[model samples]
Target: MRTSNYDKFPFVPVAKAEACQTGWAAIGAALRAALPAHATPGQPLVLAVECYPGTALGPLRQALTEALHPALCLVADDLYRAPADLDALVAGPLTDDPVFGRLNGLTVRDFLDPQKMQVAQATLAAATGQLVLVLGTGATLVCPSPTVLVYADLARWEIQLRQRRGDIANLGSDNFAEKASLKYKRAYFVDWRAADRLKKQTLPRADFLLDTNDPAAPKLIAGADLRAALAATVRRPFRVVPFFDPGPWGGQWMREHLDLPDGPPNYAWGFDCVLEENSLLLGFGAARVEIPSLDLVFAHPRELLGEAVHGRFGTEFPIRFDFLDTVGGGNLSLQVHPLTEYAFDKFGLSYTQDESYYMLDAAPGATVYLGLKEGAKLPAMLADLQRAQDDPAAPFLAAEYINEFPAHRHDHFLIPAGTIHCSGAGGMVLEISATPYIFTFKLWDWARLGLDGQPRPIHLAHGAANIQPDRTTAWVQQHLVNQVQEVARGEGWREERTGLHEREFIETRRHWFTGPVPHDTLGGVQVLNLVQGAEAVVESPTGAFEPYVVHYAETFIVPAAVGAYTIRPHGPAVGTECATMKAYVRT
Candidate 1:
């Protein structure tokens, strides 16, 4: 790799501790501090040991060391382990220090084989139910045995129902892909209501308009189509906070991108896909922000994202939330996204680039390309990149970037405007961003090809110009929060105000009243939904709190825009979907 005026070594340029959360954050901070200023087989991003949660760790770390990076292996926990095989890391390095003890009077390499990897996984997955491992590093531990269930791309939702007895179905197969070595686990997607209690609702006028590019196209922007698209729902008095399976894609995703020396379908950790908004379209201010599904809003990840559009709106549509389950670790460019000014000046675009990450998994030693490789000389760095474009034996800037980040798990970096960064491969990371599409400026790539069978294009120059050349680290340290609101809480039963959420259209909270309330009291229609273990009765602004869970806990769009109806939770009850939005707030 050649570049003009680049600096090297003396890593610890900035500390990320201020933005950290728990002890893991501290450990994350420490590990980042010790990373080598440059990466080689010998000196890399990972410099110290990191103890992850619940991992038998020692053996896993040894295996990872054999397969991935020894710099990242955690030695805090122990199992009878094999000798560290530098052969896998560096093919011909002579013995320096014996990292692990010998066994059977021979090197542990003589004893360990590929079969042992499978046995270790089976033991871990079974013992550690609800989790699995990725091939090399990290674990997809939350969702287990989730076989293949493909969703038609761009359709908002897909539903499969079984109305009669013995109406059987399956969500994923029993066999796994990749190695084609692991057998599949059988499971079906079904609702758990008794036959007698299950009401045969007409699936509620559901429809989907396939819109991938723009969000404001009348079909997706608002009106009947929007209401109809939201037909998929978890019913009243439900259990387990009904989750979206995101099936098949999980297994297939792991196999393709994560296949490595470790093996596939290794269930590790999972971060919930949070947030719902037209974030991809970065400019022109999105029309309506869907508030009903604001349950997806992980939090106000940033301080500024068009504050005008965030508060009360007397006109226009409501605030909305959107979701994306990305594959091939993109947002992958370690480029600084152009700011509103840069884009407007250059690309005639507008927006800011600030996104929060909810890390689903991080294979061991996955360090993020957080900053420059220390003491980086600016002029030399620029010249070398230019030279690469003209030379053959030289690596491109993007190639150098891939050589940089080894991003780990549960890591949240505040990607403010002008930060050059990227998430590495493996794991599902949920990106919550400002409601614009054009926040990113591509800097580097691992030279990964797209579905188009070509290396994805990069914008290193644009990204370079926008880079915020500052020394800072950690999420919490960068952004300060004055008040942290507990959204909602309860185990068996719940009934209370669900904190607060305000953006243009409506201010929402859990509204429950036992006795009678006047009609058109609040002066808007409210949509009340029953989520779990709760029975609610609504006296139609003019009527009484009805006696059923059918229309009771179900979502009933209050037609009157200026009325208050009485609400009461019966029998150890709680309501999850009990809030309203603008078009919804006035019901």
Candidate 2:
């Protein structure tokens, strides 16, 4: 089942894993072959579904009313929005300005009102032919016209791991600043840009799509295999799966390098290759599934980011990687980000966070603040970061307009957009840029708190309207440090060109190796990582296929239809050498 040259792009080829080993009887036989046989049983079979918010929805409404047996279901959270107007919009008034903190959260048009959208459109227009509704967040923006809609996605890292195992309680107030400020007010102000404008106005007038991101295999993707699995999931070689957060400079290097699942407290950021907050997975047979890596960049952004990065960041998955971990813990905020027409005229981001970091490990005297010193002054570093965020014991800021440096293991830095950076304490970094990773803006944090003990949110006037002040200290030691060169070598490999960043578009190179290298994906998408290896692999040149491997600091990804590959390392002896780094897109 390996054929996939993107059938000139349209999508829908997914079903392998021995025809997706039956799950919910393949979404009840894909809702009985996309319904409509003289609309049986009475006439109205609505079936909306839509979900997210601890969705068990009473065992998905008793498994779609016992797999569609004379159905009825209903319950859009008993027509929500009322629990005293969702507790006055979750205890209201959140305005530290940035346009009321990007118009803060709670939506789906404030969770379905208009008398719960006229009692869910008069219970899907006075149902008769098995109407199994059951929606939740903004009940599919006021339900009704749905002979099959089903969305049911779930991933904000599995709804913050089932809201930290309380098994999800209506996404809010599970502490951590009432669930990370209502998950940064519903992903930067109201549910994923209002579900990408209600999925470009309801997925081209929906009919049947249901993925339910692996509720034990709830797939259903219709028509031309959901457009050839969204144009061969953006050209293949996938990864996503990473997710870890905790902060205030959290550490213990991903709690001793990832095997995850132990209550947080440390793990600061690891959305490794943050494709809109990671997910992917999809195996099928022995059951796998997952989804959201912005669902293959909102269903094939020109086949998973290619048409010149989907015509310059439209479906926006312009590189990202992640992992900050101040090992054992502390330092990171003091940020900046914005720029690029000020993150698309202030936060409507179409591209901006130019990041870099790299490093990978570093401890004794780790340092790394960066850029700003030789005659630094941006209004005395914005009056010493507004007198240390209004006197939380002011002392911290005067380290003479920042600059620092030192960090070791591989050391890379770069940062670009507005320069001023962070890292410090021990280290680990990685970062890799420009996917607008939470538009940083920070502006100092050593006066610490966050991990919900409070005092965090700084964005000092959006980092003084995006800092840079000519990125001082000899413009960050001649352009953000480690500007290596070399490029191509061969015979036991060489590579080089480590992160140049003239305002990054993601370049980097690194390599080093000892035996194999070859590489290609020149059309685009690359990402790699193994920052000094223990293993490698990759493959493609006729060795029929199946290779991949990777490891040590692991990151992965190649896709641009893989083209030519081969990395091959794995050591314990045999000519040991390895290194890796890669990144891509710059061309």
Candidates' C-alpha lDDT: 0.30, 0.67
Q: How well does candidate 2 match the true structure in TM-score terms? A: 0.39
Model 1, range 1-587, lDDT digits (tens) per residue?
22211111001111122221122233223323423322333211222221111112334334334433332221211221232432332212212211111111122122224455455444543532121222211121111121210000111111111111122221111112211101100111011111001111101111111122122231122113333222211111111111122222232233333221234333222221121211111111323222212211112211111124334322212322212223433434445566658756653433444444434345554445554544455556566655654454675564332224444433334445665555554534444344333345655443444332544445556666876544333332333111123344443222333212121123333332343223233433233333222355444444432332322212233322324444444444443333221113313
* Residue 429 shift from truth in candidate 2, angstroms: 21
lDDT of 2 at 423: 83
Model 2, span 276-346: residue lDDT tens: 77766555345455556676676666655566766776776788787888878888877777788877765
For each candidate, what TM-score against the reference? 0.34, 0.39
